[model samples]
Each structure stands twice: as C-alpha cells, then as structure tokens.
Target: MTRDRQYSFRKVTLDDLPLLAAWQSAPHVRQWWESAEPYSAADLADPKAARWIVSTAGRPFAFMQDYTVHGWEDHHFAGLPKGSRGIDQYIGDPEMTGRGHGPAFISARMNALFEAGAPVIATDPHPENALAIAVYKKLGFEPAGPPEMTQWGLILPMLARR
Candidate 1:
C-alpha cells in the first residue's frame, strides 16, 4: 500500500541532534517524555533501536523508535510472536498536535515493520493519554490488558497483528 503523502520518515542522523534536543525540551514533549538531558550520539547508536525522524513536507516534527520485543528482557511482549516489535513515538512539534499525523505516520511505519518480518507490533502508552489510545484504536490496535507498571511508568498495553 502507498504511504499517505502527508509525511515521511528518515533515519535520524547526527546533523539532527540540535533539532532533536530542542524538540525534546519543548513543553509538550517534555511533559510526557519526562527527560531533561539532550540526546547524545550514544543514545542514537543503540543497535537494537530503529530511530527515525518523522517529517511533513520536509519539515521534521516527530521522533519514533521501534525495537524487537525480544531485545528487551521482561518487556510486555515477550510472550507474543517471536518477531514482535514495539513502537514508541512522540510528536515534538506542539503546533502539529491534534492533527491527523499521529495515525497516518504511525500506520505507515507499522506497515513497514510488518513487511520487514514483524508478525506483531505493540505499543504502551501512558494510561491517561487518551489521544494516543484513540489513535491506536483507530489504527486497529486492541487493548492487550490493563495498565501495567514499567520502568518508564504506567502504560496501557496495546497490540496489532499482521
């Protein structure tokens, strides 16, 4: 299927560090991310993580990462399909919030992950993030279980299958 023309994804690069740091520090992003440190080369070099900058008409606005569930021990998806992958994303540009980009770009990326051999995909959003839960449901992701505590905090587990 053709990706929606509204957005694109490109592997994040060192050149994007400053931009990414600025975005990470934005009030909207920081609220959920709960991080104050700027991103570093080491963070970007995580071998198990596929990181990308989500853009719209060539303007960057979001960050996304996908990793194999097995790569993270004790992760929520450990018992699912062997090739299961998990996704984490945030729209760094506050102005872009409330737009349709969340579901559009996520759906596009999820398709790519499936094509790359992921039989299942999961995402754990903060349990109170109603907007994110709604978008995931709209994209056909169903609740896998109740909210669970994780190193990051409490998340509502959700899953999608190919």
Candidate 2:
C-alpha cells in the first residue's frame, strides 16, 4: 500500500473485531502481545475499552490501546511523575512485520495523544523485545529507568518548541 493511503492511527470499532482477533492470534504476532486468551466479539464491541486499529488503505493491521494510568493503577514504574498516561500497541498481522510500519504508526499515535493534552506517555516492553525497543528509541522515546526483571520502561521525550 502507498504511504499516503495508510491509516496509521484510527479509532477501533466493533466491525474490525474479526480481523483484529485473527491478527492477535497469529503465532508471530502473539509473541509480543500479552492477550493470548480467547477474545470474543462482545469484548471488542464494548465501549469501555479505548482502542484503535492501525492500518493502511482501510485495511486493519494492528491494535493500539490507551487508558488513564491512574485508573489501572499498575505499579510497573516507580520513578515517573504522577498523572502520566500509558500506551500499548501490537502489530496484529505477522506478515506486516519488518516492513517499516511500526515507527510511523507510533509517531501518529503519539502526536494524537500529545495534541489531546497528554503531557507524558509511557510503554513497557519485555527486554527481549529488542526490535520494539529499537523502534521506540527511534521514535524519540527515551529509557525512563532500568529494565525490570521482565519489562523495560520507556518514555517519549517531552515536546520541545522548534
């Protein structure tokens, strides 16, 4: 698909569930995604979960999930200032891997969140997810703290005036 036709960051909807579920279960794709349990159509249809489908040319390719950090209250990071937001994403299609879509999708999502008044965004990945860590760093996300036993913490650089 042409770069111009890619849907880097679009809100996900119920209609895209079937495609999303398939991608999530793909062997290659499942390695990085934590949700391995069966996901029902009703789960996707639920509005309480704020998620987005990343795609190109109107075809769904990945999933992006975000929520208020305070609401989940997970103690993944201790040094980050309070009021930070968390962002998580996974490329649903294994065939699309290593084709240069991750960074573009992340940039688009970050821009959208920043514009929406989010001062900070955070993502945690297993240390072995080197490819994803590389992509995160390439997108200007700096390591926030030392890597925990299983996960590494990363934070996007604060917006700076040009």
Candidate 3:
C-alpha cells in the first residue's frame, strides 16, 4: 500500500469552476479525461451526487465525486445493489500523480462510505488506464464485470466490497 497522506475534501461550488477548468486543461488530465468537465448546475442540484475538490496541506490538487449507483435508470452501474456507490476522480495536478495521493485519498473516502452502510463501493476506470487500475487494485477493488460501454465511455467495472 502507498503511504497515507492527509487530504481534505471540500464540496464544489460555483466559485470553483474557474479553478476546475484550469485543472481540466492540463495535458495529463486531458489525456484520459479528454475534457475537464467536472459538474453542471444540474449535477450540483442532485442530492445523489457528491462533488469535491481534494487538497493536501491546504492546496487543492484533485477532483473526486461519488454517487448512487442506481441514480440513473440506464446507468452502467445501476445493477449494483441498492445503496451501492460509484466513484470517479482524477489528480488534476500531474505533480500529485506519482506521489500516492490517489490511493490514499480514495481509500479514505471509500472507507467512509463503507462505514456509512454502503455495501460496496464501485469504480469504473477506463480499460486501458493501467495507472488507475493499479490504484484501485491496490486499494482492494476487483473487477465486478467485464469492460463495457456506457454514456460516458468504455469502462472496466470494479468494486470494493465491505
């Protein structure tokens, strides 16, 4: 396991769009994310989703969100058990990528979800995203199903059971 680091999460707000946009523009983020689109007004209005900015030592460096797997009728993760949650995130700052924050913050967040009664925490990393897959695997996530396509794109559905 990667060494744990202290990270803080803050709910995203209208005031954060500019900073998020800048992070999305980074080539490292754009390579897989393609676009930096984090949230829309509708996304913020939805009680099912939680959007956040991840920071360390008081400086934000990543974006993360978790939502109900069954929130969308046709969503890929809808088949998961009710109350199961799905998460997606990116280390917007490339500088933070190789430093272990991904697994550390993500594991911390998933642990919280488990403690809150989540039966399983799901993740759908792109099939070719080895780095992301590694991070998930290191945190005990395993393939829940084969790779498949959805409205967002292709994904390898994975889950960490409680």
lDDT of 1: 0.86
The parts of candidate 2 lying over 4 Å away from their true place are 1-5, 38-49, 77-83, 149-162
Model 3 TM-score on a 0 to 1 scale: 0.93
Measured over all alpha carbons after superposition, the RMSD of each candidate to the real structure, in angstroms, is 2.2, 4.4, 1.6
Tens-digit lDDT string for candidate 1 (64-135) = 989888877887778888888999898988898887788889998999999999999999988888888999
Candidate 2 lDDT over 1-162, as tens digits, reads 235645656666666667777877888777767666544667655543467888786667778876555554454643345545567788877777777777788777777777777677777776677887888777777776666653333333221110
Predicted structure 1, TM vs. truth: 0.91
Per-model CA lDDT versus the true structure: 0.86, 0.66, 0.88
User: Which candidate ranks first by TM-score, i.e. highest?
Assistant: 3
lDDT accuracy of residue 79 in candidate 1: 87
Clashes of 3: 0
Q: Looking at candidate 1, what is the lDDT of residue 44?
A: 76
Structural similarity to truth (TM-score) of each candidate: 0.91, 0.76, 0.93
The best candidate by lDDT is: 3
Runs of candidate 3 with Cα error greater than 4 angstroms are 1-4
- Would you list the clashing residue pairs of candidate 1? none
Q: Which of 1 and 3 is the better model by TM-score? A: 3
lDDT by residue (tens digit), candidate 3, 32-67:
785667567887879989999999989899999999
